[model samples]
Structures are given as C-alpha cells and as structure tokens.
Target chain A: MVTIPFIWIMGDLLWNGWDQLSFSFVFSAPQNAGREGGIGPILISTLLIVGVCMGTAVPMGLGTALFLSEYTRHDHVLGRLIRGSLDVLAGVPSIVFGLFGNALFCQILGLGFSILSGGLTLACMVLPILIRTVEESFHAISQEQRLSAAALGLSKTTTIRRILLPAALPGLLVGIILGLGRAVAETAALIFTSGYVARMPESLMDSGRSLAVHIYDLAMNVAGGNPHAYATALVLVGLVFIINVSSSWIASRWTSCNRLSA
Target chain B: MPFSTFFFFTLRVFLVGPLLWAWAWEYPSARAEGERLIITGSSTMAPLVSEIGKRFETLHPKVRVDVQTGGSSRGIADTVNGLADIGMASRALKSQEQHLNGSVIAHDGITIILHTSNPVQELTDDQIRSIYTGSSTNWSHVGGPDSGITVVNKAEGRSTLELFLDYFHLSNRDIHAHVVIGDNEQGIKTVAGNPNAIGYVSIGTAQYDAAHGIGIRLLALQHIPATLETVREGRFPLSRPLTLVTKSPPAGLVKTFIDFAQSPQVHDLILQQYFVPLQG
Candidate 1:
C-alpha cells in the first residue's frame, strides 16, 4: 500500500517531466518566473543552504548528544530538562520555526532575507532530531566498552574520542543524513527566511531560491508552470534518493572496515 | 585507526569547505557593492514583477532586482519598514495605509465558475450567498438541475479567498466549502472535473483554461458578461489593481524600474501573464 503511492508519484513525475529534463534545464538560470530556462541558480542555493545547515547542526548536535549521554546520568535534572525541551521542539510545526527565524535571524540579527538566515533556521529545526538520534546511538553502546576504556587508564575525553564515537559512527551518520533530508525538503521554513529570489547567490548574504521553493512557486503560483514544476520535483526526488543510497553505502563500508580492524 | 582518521578528516573538510568558499566569494562582492533593488510582497503579483525585474536587469547591467513573495500585507509591512525598495500589492491600500504611495500596473478580476456541463446559466448575488452559506445546497434551488452543489473555496491566507469574501459580503467562517483549494488552477481543475461544482478564480486564468477546453464555464455578474473586455473596461465588479507601493516617493533605480514597468514596452509581458495592462 505504501509502495503504491510512491510508485504512482514517481510514474506521474517521469511521465510529465522526462522530456523536459535536459543538461540546460539543470544548468541555466530560470527566466519568466520559472516558465522557461533551467534551475542552475536554484541548485546552487539549495546546496549552500543544506551545507550551512549541516555545518552548524552537526557540531552542535554531536556535542549535545555527547553531553547528554556521557556527562550526566540519565535521570539528571538538567539532562531531563534538555531532553524534554528537545522532544517538544521535535514535535513543533516547521511554520512556527520559520516565523521565529524570520523574527530573530532576519530582523533582529540583521541577516535580512539571505541564505545564512535560512540555513540557521533549518539548523534549529533539525537539531532536536539530530541530537535525539545521536544520543540514542551513544546510549546503545555497551557499558562493558566504557568499563574497559576506564580500566585502560583512558581519560573521559579520550574514551569518547576513541571508543564511543567510533562505535556510534553509524548512528551519527544516520542522524546527519536525516537532518540533511529535512533541510533539503523544507519549503515553509525557507520561504520566509531564505526568501524567494531565484538569482545565483554570489555570497551567503544574497537571497536565493531553494529547489523546493521553486517547485512550489512553479506549481502553485505561476500559471502554466506545471511542466517545469514536474521537472524540478523529479530532480529533487532524485537528489533525496542519491543521498539515502550513498549514506547507507558509507555506513556499510565503515562498519566492515571497523570489523576488519578489530 | 588510519581509516577512521581519514574519515573524520574528510568530514571536517566537507563541513568547513563550503563556509570558507562562501566567505571568500563574499569578500570581492563586499568591496564592490553594486546597486540592489529589493521588491517584496503579494504572491499574486510576484510572478509578473519577477518577469519585469528580469527585463529591468537586462537593461541595466550593474543593477540587481530581488523579488520576494509572502502576501500583500507583508509587502505593505516590508515597504513601511524600509526592508523593500518597492512592495507589490494586488489590492489598493486601505485608508490607514494611505501614507504609502501606490502605483497601479495592471488589473485582475475574480469570476465565478462552474463545470460547462452545468445547466445553470446565471445566478444572482443572493443565490451565490445562499449556496455558499449552505442555505441552498441543491442546484435546483438556484435555477439548475436537481443535483447537489459542490462549493469549492480558496484556502485560508489566499488573497483570492480574501477578495472573494469581500465581494460576497461573507466571512470565512460563514463558508461551508465542500472542497478547499490553494490556487486558481486547482480550483478550476476541481470545478472542471466535477459536473456540479462551483468555484471562483482569476478571470484571466479561467478564460485561458476554458478556451483550452478545460470543461469549465465563467458565469457573468449582475447581467454583465464575465469577459476580459468587461474587466479591461473597469466594469467587472470584483476586480483589483496590481499596485507597486513605496514608503516614500520612488527615486533613483526604484523610480526608473517602476517607470519601465508602467511603460508600453512591457505591455506584452504583462498581457502574457494573463493580467490586463493599464490602458493609456
């Protein structure tokens, strides 16, 4: 039943967009409100937005997960408080985050409607999910490993660097991939933050349209924009598929290498 | 150990490389800042303004025009707050917003639509209100077949919905919609597919789609035909101007861009988007 919807959507996209997909379609700037030309600028903007999101989210998520798993007991008041807030944040609608981001990042911080603000907003939205996933991965590590590291006279930081991190690498990769998927597919949060400009971004401060936003505008707002909208959607789906497949491949290769070393 | 080290090294490079590249690109542009005009507001007017901005950019090589869309209210707010060089509002500014200067570029009309298969040729204002409010659920109640009427309404936050409500003297809460749609095309599609469905959408979009044999019909209002000619003549009761607003009198690049937008050179572009250019 689940696969039926997926197949149906893929078939529809291919049926409508296959002829329109070309090298120029992916590499040229959009003209006439996306009725013609390609999505080159939009592609770069999506990449930069996702890159900024991952760059900020990974470090913060990793640190928070480590602190939650290693620096405090499971029942510690502060840890519990942080966990509670993260859980709540994970459930909050993305539109709320978009509004908050617009107020804080775009207005207060003077980032204006730029890729930086959009990326920062996406980072905030994905952090809770990333941290929870990574923390669970950390907790899944056996206690015997920690005891063995302690018996080896290793410091807490050393134990984390060598033992916990390597052991939990798959989970960390999963967390990052999940966060990337969310950041790339986001539309509501980005529309108000990164904004609606379809120009090629020369810098982080320039407003550039993301692929999802382009698809949205072409599909809903622009009259007779369906052909290009379908093509853009097909490209987005292809991107998500590639990200998922490559992440799983990397996870498997890393695990096999670790087993060989052990 | 070497494998893990290599992996972390690659990861670090992946994360930090983009940041470094972004900063490097920013440096040269920062030193040589060019003229940038930011236009924000009204999703309805955004596509047209974007096309105009593109032509404007080609004419002025060094200048950049950035267009953003949220809604008409956002356009007003952004303009008043000085965040935008110009704001695009599809409707005229209210009395309180009169402080801002508004220049009309085009006109768009909202029209009632039905499936062409529907036998009802016309409806009075009272009939439409009754049908929308659920007081009249059958087409027979409004001089049509005895089948049930499906009311297709625009979703909340859509300017179309707001305009619809304003023209009909009805609030959103009073609407008993059978199907809520997001855009003009969607509403037209829904009504086209359903023999008994009635909806309202942009007259230009409806006319284009109907001409292309989309199985939808545009209904006249108050005995006047629902045609582009009527709208152009300013006889359409439910029409709104596509306006460009500024906090202060436009000067410099902003003034030049607005003038170019209103000039006859872009009338074909305006007509191409299915909006009526202001007649000289």
Candidate 2:
C-alpha cells in the first residue's frame, strides 16, 4: 500500500524522461540549464560527490561503531553521552546542516564551495545511522563466539580484528548502502557547501553540482526545465539502484567466502 | 452501543460546526466599508502595490484594496480575465497585451555587480560580453586576479532576464552560466561570495545592499555611472518602467488608486523602497 505512490512517481518520471534520456543527453555537456545537449558534467559531479561522501562516512562510521560496542560499557558515562549525541545528530535537520556546513567548512575552514566540504557535511549527516547500525550488528554477535576466540589463545584485539570484523561485515555493508542512498539523494546540505556549479570538479576545491541539486535547479528555476529534471531523476534512480545491487552482491560474496573458509 | 457512538459523533460535530462556519464566512471588506479592489501580477511590483494600497485605504475609507503577486504574464492574464482590478508589470506591454492599458508607476534599472575586493573597477561593454560568452576565461585578462570567472545568470521568465538579453542582443541559450539564480538578492550574494564571479541585478537593490555594507559594487554601464541621479536624469541605458496594468479604463476605486499611485502622494514611499518616482 505504501509503495503504490512510490511506484506511481517512478512510472511518471520514466514516462517523462524516457524520450529525453538518449546517448547525447547523457554524454554531452548541458548547453543551457539542461534544456539541450546532455548532462555529462553533472553526471560526473554526482559520482564524484558520492565517492567523496562514502569515502569519508564509511570508515568513520565503522570506527565509531566498533568503539561504542567493544571499548566501553553500555552504562558508562562516555558511552551514554556518545549514544545520546548520535541520536540528537540524526534528528538534526539537513537545512541546518547546510548552514553549519557553510559557516564551518566553506567559511571558517576555507574549503569554500567544493566537493570536500559537501562530502564532510554528508559524513556528519550519516554518522548517527552508521554508528547505530554497526554497533547493533557487533552487539548481536554471540558471547560464545568471543569466548571461543579467547579459548583458542587469540588476544582480545586479534579476536575483534579477525572474527568480529568479518562477522559484522554484512551489517557494515548495510550501513554503507543506507549512507550512500542519503548522500546520493541529498540536495539541501550540498547547496550551501558544494554550490550549484554544473561543471567537472577539477580539484577538491572546485564547486560542483550533484544530480539532486541539478534536478532542483532545473525543475524550480528554469521555466521549461521539467523534461531535463525528469531525465536527471530517472538517471539518479538508475545509478542508486546499481549501487544497491552491487553492494549487496559484494556482501553476499564475502559471506559465502567466509563460510567456505570456516 | 452503536447509537451511543453515533450520538457522540453528532455531539462533536455540533461543538465544532460554528467554528468552521465562522472560518469559512469571512467579514469581507469590513475595514474599507464598501467595494473590494484586487490588484495582481509582477512580483517586483507587489511591494510597491502593497505600500500604495495601505495609503489608499486610509484616504478612501470606503474602498478595500487587495494586492497579489505572480509575474507579469499573470498580471496581464488576470486583467484580461477580470480576475483582478489592476495588474502590475515591471516590463513594457507587448502588442498583443496592448488590449490592456498600462501606466508607469516607477522605474528601475539592471546593472553589472561584482565583489568589492576585485581590482577591476569597470569593464568595457565588449569585455563584459566576452566574459559572458566564455571568450574571456580569466579575471586577470580583464584586469582582476588570475582565476576562472564564474558567471551568475538570472533564470528564464524573469523580466530582468528579458531586459538583460534584449539589451545585450544575446540569447539566453548561448551564454554559459556557472550559477543560475532566481532573485536579485541571490545574484548579489553569489557575486559577493565569489571574487571571480560577476552578475547583473537591480541597481537600486545593489546600491541599497552596498549602503548596508554587503560587499558588492555596481560597475559603470558604458562609461555612465549607475546611480539614482543618472537614472532620474534619463542617462542610464538599462532603465525599465514599472507599470500598473488595467484591462479596461479603470473605474471607481481602481481609478482613484491608480491615480494616487502615479501622483505625488506616494513619492516618498516609492523612493524609500529604492525606486525612482513616476515623475522623477
């Protein structure tokens, strides 16, 4: 029942964008506000930002999750404080994150309107979910698994490194996938940080517009930009779908490989 | 049990019925005591109309003036459709739109703006054209620092965009824009933020922002300064008249209000909003 509207929207975008989504539309530089030619540069910017966001978020999330689960007691003040802060962070609005990102990364830090600043903002946004997911997965591992690793004369650090990490791989991948989704779909946070420049990112300092921002700019500002906006949305959906499938495949292969080794 | 439930539902409805009725039935035109006037169109003209409407209400005491904003097209449409008593337009009426009468109420001009820190104080018309066309890539080639120039352009359908394109003799499709902004403030902000960026916006707005210490400077247009004095003297080239449109010859309160808006009564108000008066 919930997915009825989702299906309807997807169908509508595909129907609208299908005619415009040709090879030239995807490969050539936009001639005028995505009204002509292609979204080649915009597509590149979108992928560059996703790469940057995932690169920053995943390791930080995994590390924080490990710290919360293994290093501290649940009732410890520091642990409780970390958990409380993560909860609050998750609830913080994306627009507020945009402002904060502008003030800190763009202004104070002097990163300016670049992919680096946008990626950092997205990293902060996805942190809470990452921390909670990885922590839950690590905690769900049996007590006997740890006891056996110890009985086999493995050090606590070694057991956590080899056994715990591989065992929690599936959950970590889930966290990565969710973070990627949020990062790919994000527009507000990137508006202030990355800016709305439809150009290839020459360096980390160069401003670039992501796919989500491109749709927003095309759909809202330009008078006759709906077709291009729909096409970009369709392409964005396809890209996210591909990422989702590939990550799940990688997770499955890991699990299967681990099972064979054991 | 069903009867009790039904009784409770009817009781709840009875309790809320009057509140909903009162909300739906508004006391129309109570303040002005008589006729209602609807003014629609041109977002740029909305503020001025709203200001004049307030003053007109006080003077008439028996007429209600309502101001609405969409765009110039809506203003013309509303006038033609009899949806509004008057339409406000920031651009000149087309030949097809000449079915309606338009009276100039105020004047504003578009001018090039830049970050205050840029070393280049003025740019030649050709230099600006080249910059907009992507022929001039670096700020240093035109006398600023060596950096890639970011062109901030206005979105389509805005009268400002129309005026800019017409004045430059360029098509909107040809100019490569780094950022396409909707409003004047956004253009000013984009220019203020980027030392290498240049954009055009309402000169009055740019002047106001500059007075308030917003790090933006208006450049001279074709060797003539963009100032209130120049615009009033008819020396500025980019000037556009802001008009109040009427489908038919305005009658009653609409006639009275349009006359008042074009008279000396709202001169101070118009100037306060950083627009040139109809006479000036």
Candidate 3:
C-alpha cells in the first residue's frame, strides 16, 4: 500500500517531468492562461524565508539550549515553567502559530504581511526542535570540557559562545537543517499570515510566498492549475535537497575540525 | 491464452505504470482526453461547483470534476492562464480580465457584520467608506459604542473587497492598516468574537454562530438592509455577482458545467447555500 502511493507519486512526476523541467517555466512568471510564466522570484522568496527563519531560529534555539543544558543545571521553578512553556509552544500546530503571527506580528506588532512575519512565525515553530537538538548536543559533551573552560577562566557566556557552541556545531547544524526543511515546506500558516505576493522580497516586511504556497496557489487557486504545478513541486524538492546536502556537508566539515582540534 | 496473458501482464507492469506516471506528471492535462473537467478558484464558488460536480459526475460516471478554491482573483487568473475549466469569482472582473468570459453563477450580499452585543444599527455610505478606509477609526464617531473601531478587512486582491472598493469608489483608499484576514470564514469569526470589530463577509458564512462567541449582527445601511431581497433588487450597495469564468468560452465538459451551473437546480442549491441565484 505504501509502495503504491509512492509509485503513483513518482509516476505522476515522471509523466509530467519533461514539460515541467524546462528552464523558462523555472525562470518565468505567469502572463495569463494557456501561456508560460517563470517562478524565479517565488523561488528566491522561498529561499529568503528559509534563510531568515534560520537566522532567527539558530540564535534563539541555541540560547534556549545553552540556558537549559549549562546555565540552569540547578532545578528551579522558573526554569521548569519555561521548559514546560517551550514544550507547549513546540506542540502547537503550524496553523496556530500562523494565527498568532497574524495577530501579534502582522497586526499588533504592525509588521504587515511580509517575509519577516512568516520567518518569525516559522522561527517560533522551529525553536523547540532546535533547542532540544542543541540541548542534547550540549549534554553529550563531557563535564571535563566545561571544567577545562572554567580552568581557562572564561566567563559563562564566553564559554557558551565559543567553547560549547563550536563543540555542539554538528548537532546544531542538524537542528537548523530540519528547521529549514519545515520552514520551506510549510504552507497553511503562511497562506493567511505571510501574504502571497509573487514579487521578490525587497525587505523583511514585504509580502511573499514560498514554493509550497506557490504550488498550492497554482493548483488550487489559479485556473487550469497553472500546468506548472509539477515544475514548482520539483523545484521545491530540489531546493530541500540542496539545503539538506549543504547542511550535511558543513556539519561533516565542522565534525572533522572538532576532531582535529581534539 | 497463457502466453497472451503473460505478455499482457508484462505490458501492464511496464507500459501501464509508465503511462500512468506520465499522466500524473503531464501539466494536469489528461491528453485533453477522457471526461475529466478540472475546476479551480474562488472558495465562495467552491460549494456551488462541488454540488454541480457531484451531480455531473453521477450523470456521467466516466467523467471526473476536480474543484479547488483559491479566491476570485486566482480564479480569474487561472481562467485567463488556462489552469481551470471554470474560475468562480465572487467579484466582477477587472478591465484587464476582459480577455476571458465571466458568466454570473450567483449573486451574494456582502453583509456589514458586527458582534451581536454591538448596539450600532446602521451606517451611511460615507461612514462605511470612511471606516473601511481608516479615516473614521472609532465607533464613537459612527454613533456606536465608545470603543475604537477594529476594522477587519480581507487581504488585498480579494474579490469581495475589490467589489466593495469599486462599488463605493474607495479604490484609492489606504486599507493596508486594517486587520486583514484571508477568507470569509475567518472574517466572520473575527467580527463575531470582538464586540468592537466590524468586517464584511459573504452571507453564506455569516449565518453560522461563531465558536463559543456571540453571533454577528448584519448591519442595516442607509435604510437598505443587507438581505437577500435588498441584494437581489440592487438596493444593498455591497451586493455583487459571483461568477465562473472560463478561457475562450468553454466547450464540451466545460460547456456542460457552465450549463448545469446556470440551471434551476443550481439556483435552488445556491438558495440553500444562502446565495441569491443570478437569475433571481
């Protein structure tokens, strides 16, 4: 049963593959019905959203992980509450996060439907996952590393920024990769919150849509389903592949550096 | 017979699988063959199209109709681009959209909905324009409660808002500051929840009571109620035609869909869905 669905999905892609794999369709925007349009700007917008999401998520998620693993080792009430809150926040669906983003960032915060709002919402979704991954990395590091850093008389913050972060870089990169994938693939939350203008995102606050949203919009929103839905899907898959491979390569490099230093 | 059966089985494994795969990937075109009619656009038109699709599919079991909803601009865009066999729009076409044919499937009243507790009864045309355009920012200015008017608006390019702007001549107005929701369902919920909030939504989605909140009150404007009669008679200013646009005038299955959509059964379905039929 599982194999059949996958086979069908692949077959669908293969059947449409040749017509969809054209460079012009990849690069052009839609002019009208029964014609062609490039999705170049949309592709860039998806990348930008993923980039901004990572930019915010990495620091925040890393900070949370550091606080939990190193700073708040002693059992405390506030720490426990914060941990509980993080769990709840992570558990919340992407749609709810989108609603919150719409209200808090887009409306109350007055950042209109822009890349910034979508990225920030996605950051909120990814934070818990990033934090958990980073925390696990930090926990895996021996206590001897922390003691040695203390022996060097480095400040707690400095140790976290330099010693612990570099040590946890491999796992941290994994968290980032996962978050990037989520941000790139996510649609429902983005539809209402991000605003789906096709133009390239000039600033953080400009309204934009990702590849997934673009595909959905084309298939479900537009007539004739845009004929390029498969192409867009292919592009999204390709983009995800690029991000994962690059992140994996960087993680491998970082791991090698850590080994050499050790 | 055994040799032939084995040969056929081999063909199924290779040719059938590859063909099916190719069919799946082929720009949503089913060789432009068979009895598949793909319809997309206008969530407002979705319910109506689905009803027609269900009946149509039953009549011709070999035929399949896929209905998808984006919104009206998308519907028009899809029709112009040949993505949909029919693009259902709640608003009229733009001047640029003259390239396609827009047939009115139904008519809808755009209700000025408020929280049930809101004592404000009516708004003038000028007041409506000012409120939506953000000139009059509070209910106190409009002879309502002392609360600041929370103007919830549909996102830009939404067909409903497009019609409202054109009807009221508020096209150049800056509505970017309003709390912009995407669909009619969300707009109805937002207004129903907040007593100080005012928003416009289709009459179909406005009828249901909000989740654990007060039902919304459809405001009367300038002695013209936002009702079925007022909308059909063209007394209500916010009323607009709902359409299913097609590329180059639909033929075959597309023509059939348009025909069924324009029929009395569809009109009855529209009535049940709380939308006034085009003929009505």
Candidate topping TM-score: 1
Q: What is the C-alpha lDDT of each candidate?
A: 0.90, 0.78, 0.71
Cα lDDT tens digits for candidate 3, A25-97 = 7776543311246687677667667666776787688788888888785377777877788889878888898
Q: In model 2, what lDDT does residue A173 have? A: 73
Q: How good is the docking of model 3, by CAPRI class?
A: incorrect
lDDT of 2 by residue, A230-257 (tens): 9989999999899889777766666666
Q: Write the per-residue lDDT of candidate 1 for residues A21-70, one digit (tens) a residue.
A: 99999999997789899999999899889889989999999999999999
Q: What would the per-residue lDDT of candidate 2 be over residues B1-280, giving only the tens digit for each residue?
A: 2322333344234324433332343343134346667776765666567667767767876665655445777678778877678988888887778778888988988889989988899998889888888899899889888898999998887788878888888899879899998767667778888988899988777887788787889999899999977887778998788999998888776788889999998998788667788675
Instruction: Write down the C-alpha DockQ for each prediction.
Output: 0.64, 0.01, 0.02
Give TM-scores for every candidate, taking all chains together and pairing residue i with residue i. 0.96, 0.52, 0.51
Residue A150's lDDT within candidate 3 is 94
All candidates in order of TM-score, best leading? 1, 2, 3
Candidate 2 residue A153 C-alpha distance from true site, Å: 1.8
User: What is each candidate's fraction of native interface contacts (fnat)?
Assistant: 0.54, 0.00, 0.00
Q: Model 3 segments beyond 4 Å from truth?
A: A1-11, A33-35, A152-154, B1-240, B243-280
Give per-model CA RMSD. Answer: 1.8, 22.1, 17.6
- Model 1, backbone clash pairs (residues 3+ apart or across chains), number: 1
lDDT (C-alpha) at residue B231 in model 3: 77
lDDT of 1 by residue, B131-195 (tens): 99999999999889899999999888677888889989999999999999976778887998999
Q: What is the TM-score of chain B alone in each candidate?
A: 0.89, 0.88, 0.82
